[model samples]
Target: MSEPLLEVKDLNIHFFTDEGVVKAADGVDLIIERGKTLCLVGESGCGKSVTSRSFLNIIPSPGKIVSGQMLYRQQLPDGTTTTIDLAALDPKGKDIRRIRGKEISMIFQEPMTSLSMMHTVGDQITETIRLHENVSKQEARDRAIEMLRLVGIPKPARLIDEYPFRLSGGMRQRTMIAMALCCNPTMLIADEPTTALDVTTQAQILDLMLELQQRYNMALLFITHDLGVVAEIADEVAVMYLGKIVERADVDTIFNAPKHPYTQALLHSIPKIAMKREELDPIKGMIPNPYRRPSGCAFHPRCSQVMERCKHITPNVTAIQPDHTVRCLLYEDMPEQVTQKEAMHHD
Candidate 1:
């Protein structure tokens, strides 16, 4: 309701493969309120990573942003509303460099990949702290030590001296978080931060992130395929398919009142011990290739509830509630969707 801390509107990304240009992301629109967590959830290769990367203008070259507007908080004095035309920003511009870590930071999918194996974890965090702030080495080191402790790394004094290869996966991830938080960025983009860890470690990392998010009052863009994880930390959820969002809603509305058929299928696919084995539903089709997306509604080919109109018409997002939206004809008449859906089961 208040001005969003960050706004992503009509974002489209295209990649130049050996074969052809692939549309990795299409028409993505999202709003993040200050201190809220928005989880982008879907199956692997659904553009969650690409969308997150685009925020900081890090989508690999040859893969360019075709269209988009990424606006950061408008109140900053250095710049009014930074509506970065991601496609137009020169690599040498100060805008992105200034925001990269100080205003927005990212925690990559793999901890090992993000961490510098050659540097001591302490040195890395301290360097990041000094890079953004006018602080002495001692001050930076002290801040780094404090961050290590905040992330729950055991023996902060000893662990900060270790290299990435020297620690376990969980500890390595904590080190990554420490580095990311060193600058106290306005927002944090976490892309599958728990993907590589074992379930126990995954739970702990998720818990730690939630705690840190609360402590720092950060706007978090959490990307994960796990609906279960979405249930745990997301204040809001966006269900993405090949290159577009099929549904977006508050956590409870998403879990209990899914409007898009794809969303319903996705939520149903989450394994439940309570569900009968045969009654459990799995979505029928694999993700379509980005280069050869299905015409009209991308989900039409796989959607169980697909109608003839779905094959030729790209569904637009229709608001079903103040906080809920779905890209489906079923939601064409917000009120009728509720009545029609209910009538179908009536005697």
Candidate 2:
């Protein structure tokens, strides 16, 4: 197997607020290879977005990565490979800045607020290109126009000069993609990029992103709450709850034979065409507040297959199949004493 482009291990990020510390991300482990897409799926406030933002050290104020190792394999100009621990790098220092746009770029959830309304889209794109590359102004502008065209913007020459406000949601998103890919980064972190678009536009954006990923041979960290999108675009899927990944497996296994109760609930929640009249089986209970996260398993409160130990002890992440892993007591082998205790408790 080829070396992974990026690997995150035991990542923990938190936000210190007046209320309390919010554990936005807890022990997230993920891997993304070149030209492959790893979809991070979870409900709102489940740390999917936070995990992606950590890649570029762009987590908003009051939030900080408490512990983790983000190993990034970078190919230098001389064609030599070096692995750097991104978590240890200074967030706003020169080294990270050099890598952020050139080696890895991100498309945030909302393009309207992400793009500056004061500047022409053309200027923004070209400025990003020039920031990482030592290119002349005209050359940068030409490259920006080419990127706009590449992203399927009509009349790229005219559109480039228009401000972001003038474009529709889809158009703005396309412009964002154009800006992100202009540098030909090795990895792209797209956080719910299609959330605000209509279904048709969402499909178009997904298709466009997939096409661009292939063209550039870049790895993708796609964060979304949409299972349908995961089924359509993801080679691997990681199901998260609260903060930790509850399950990790191939896309087909995730959809067809999910092992974690949380994963099962999420899959069951998806509306089905064959069962048109049936109501969606929404997961019971809400995701617990981060400040007062539930004891033991963070997801025990909502997990349908909760066990006695789930409320008292955290289950270690265990591998069931070759590439599939789950953090649930159901998969663990219980000692005879513990089994007898559980049986007596039930009686």
Task: Give the candidate number with the greatest lDDT.
Answer: 2
**Candidate 1 lDDT for residue 343:** 40
In model 2, residue pairs whose N, Cα or C atoms come closer than 3 Å (at least 3 residues apart or on different chains), thus clashing, are: none
Report the lDDT tens digits of candidate 1 across residue range 1-347. 77788888888998888988877788988888779999999888878888888888888878788887777773466666545454456645787777787778999879876788899998888888887789999999888989999998878988878888999888888889988888887799999998899999899888888888888899999998788899988999998988888899999999989989999999888888677888878899888877788876889888999876566667788989878988997667535455455445432
Write down the lDDT that model 1 would get. 0.84
Report per-prediction Cα RMSD to one decimal: 5.4, 2.5
Candidate 1 lDDT trough over 10 residues, lowest sum: 338-347
TM-score of 1: 0.91
What lDDT would candidate 2 get against the real structure? 0.90
**Candidate 1 Cα errors over 4 Å, as ranges:** 74-88, 274-279, 333-347
